[model samples]
Target: MPDLYSRRSFIAGVITAGMLSTATGYLLTRRTPVTLTLVTGGDATGGRSLLINLWNRFNPDVRLDVLTVNSSTRDQYDKFAGTRADIYNLDVIHIPRFAARGRIAPIDPPDGITLLAPVQRVSQVEEGSARLWAVPLNTDVGMLYRRITDKRATDAEPEIGRLVADRTQVRQLAAQLATEGSTTDEAFVINVLEQALAQDRTILDERGVVSTSLGQWQRALAPLAAALRDNRIVAVAGEEKTNAAFQERNLRYMRNWPVWFPAIDREERDKKPGTAAIRLGRLPIGVLGGQGLAVAEDTGYRDEAEAVIHFLTGMPAQKLLATYGFAPTASEAYNDPEVKAAMPHLEIVRSAVEDAHPRPMSAGYADFAQVFRQHTYDYLYRGVQLTDGFVEGMQGALR
Candidate 1:
């Protein structure tokens, strides 16, 4: 059977290209130009850089009036739910929730819109349905970076054998090796130990929700607390601070978004080339993510809008993006020799993408992430009991 994306693309090409652009289509094409209102985060210039490039390259005859909204994530979601913006940069999961609410326009899969292939599989929209509500732009995935120096130290035959067999044993040896104090100076670091805990199978229910089973929580959370208590982790600061710490050599193995890792490696390498040790790995069983593109339901020039989207996601653009530090969503990019050379660790990210678990799709998902971050921070940093914090947040979302 053709995959969902291939099938949808065939259907869309046949219907949209043949039907929408018939002789009658010229009637609509010649009218006053329609402008697309794009609301995204960051400065308008930088925010729409990708789309603007596509617009310039494709020149769909439709004027794109990009509106880069400078607002907090929470503020943006509030505005979107209030039916304030026509198009916004949103997480993949939130698309379904908003679609279900009818606040945003339907993102019908058929016709001209270019939705990300991966997203189509997870989207709640029906197969062969022309109306699509959301699409992914750039996907983010979690990565495990370990200290190359530490990895080297443990390469001796005796240590290598032990490290490969069990992750727990590896971490324990790392913690001990880190304590030995060497002039080389490195430490194995990860996000607050709780992140590792969350990755364990015991913590998630069959539906992929956080499991409420008390036994599961204990089994998972215990090692995490111990890792934290043992100081194997650098304090779980937010992303900015965490990156800063890594650059400063305060961390060894850390969990970070793949997009930022190369930049981090570069910055460190420039200052201490071949000195600041670095290695990347697929996230261990958790912390997976990916990004894709979608067209707006409210885009007046649907054909033009899709033209721009398709050009952006097309093979050429995707290949270009891979050069600029982005992990390509298209599967083919992984095997490209040039892409592999530029990003040697691309396969690790590919594996991460393959296993990527999207965030929750509830209408309340954005709000849920806000609460979830708090729960993680409170337990990891603020000393709040893990169970109480997680339960409170989940219950609030359920409510």
Candidate 2:
């Protein structure tokens, strides 16, 4: 009886020891927590807020650090090249440039994941190949914001030269608004480069050759030049300022992106009685703008980084984007009942996005854009004539 009891105790002790050892081994070999850095452009507070919230909700184990480099696409590329950021939210037009320079890694999404047709088409980078280089986060297109009392929105394409001729029409519009008791101080605020690009009049051709001629550029800038001289238009630095001017009800028509819808709605809601009202309308043709997530080729946590990308570009995130007033890259998000309710004119925005054209895609796009911007600024703001020599100088700058 004594020997039997001792043997039973020994057996129990050995079993307990084995279990402890197995548990310890499992814990030792477990995966460690991963930290990823995400760098993007634009308003860090608005769009980044949504992303951070979603990340915390979906990826509790991984740590996400976001940085906003609110400068040019060139600035973003420079940061990505110099920093250790695990992921980059780059402009879709810059994907080819980044991929060509080996600044970003090609992505292979999981089997069940898919992007909208237009976004998917843009996501593919390499010529003559189906390799997806980036994950589309959102889509943007130029839009016109006006007073709700304005005439029914039309798709009438403006004649570039006629619209800016002597600023006569713009001055007349301003006078008409004044007569109607509108407090608007400006008739228009034009983004010359964006307008030109949206109209498919890019400085560089598909072959990366300088394609813009003096006559074409003159037609594009003539309207803006007239407005500047006549004080009928205000030349804003970018969209943020344009949106601000429009929000203050100081301008009649403002060209901006659809992302401003939510803020505009909020302004309307918070306005005091008798404040200026605002409305959104489709651009005749919009310049496509948006960002895509690209993983760093040297990231140690490739799988985790990819998972983060999947979550961001996923349905849940896309739905949140739509709700937050961004144009989502997923087709399903557009059809979402709640999203439609939040943005009544989402259908119009969708149509505009469908018709929008992306900027020129080239390895030298940065240089081309710089040249175009300089020439346009001089022509429109500084009253520089669009001469043959000016065109030659622009072409030379492209080289």
TM per candidate comes to 0.71, 0.76
Candidate 1 Cα outliers beyond 4 Å, as residue runs:
1-30, 43-51, 57-60, 81-86, 106-119, 124-132, 149-199, 205-207, 274-277, 290-294, 370-378, 381-396
Candidate lDDT scores, in order, read 0.49, 0.59
Runs of candidate 2 exceeding 4 Å displacement = 1-30, 45-47, 57-60, 109-118, 127-130, 150-190, 197-210, 275-277, 388-399
User: Residue 166 CA error for candidate 1 (Å)?
Assistant: 12
Residues 89-144, model 2: lDDT tens digits: 88876787778888778886434444555566667765544567888888887676
Question: Number of the top candidate by lDDT?
Answer: 2
Q: How many residue-pair clashes does candidate 1 contain?
A: 15
Candidate 1 residue-wise lDDT, 1-399, digit = tens: 124224333433332333222313322243566666666655321313653544543344565566655544445555555543435556455565656656455443323334334445555366656445544445556666665544356632222222323345323222211211121111111132224334464353222355555445545555555555555545433455556666565354555666665566655555664544556766444333443344555556666656444544544455555545566666665676655655667777777666555544466755565565555545544567667657666657745
lDDT of 2 at 52: 60
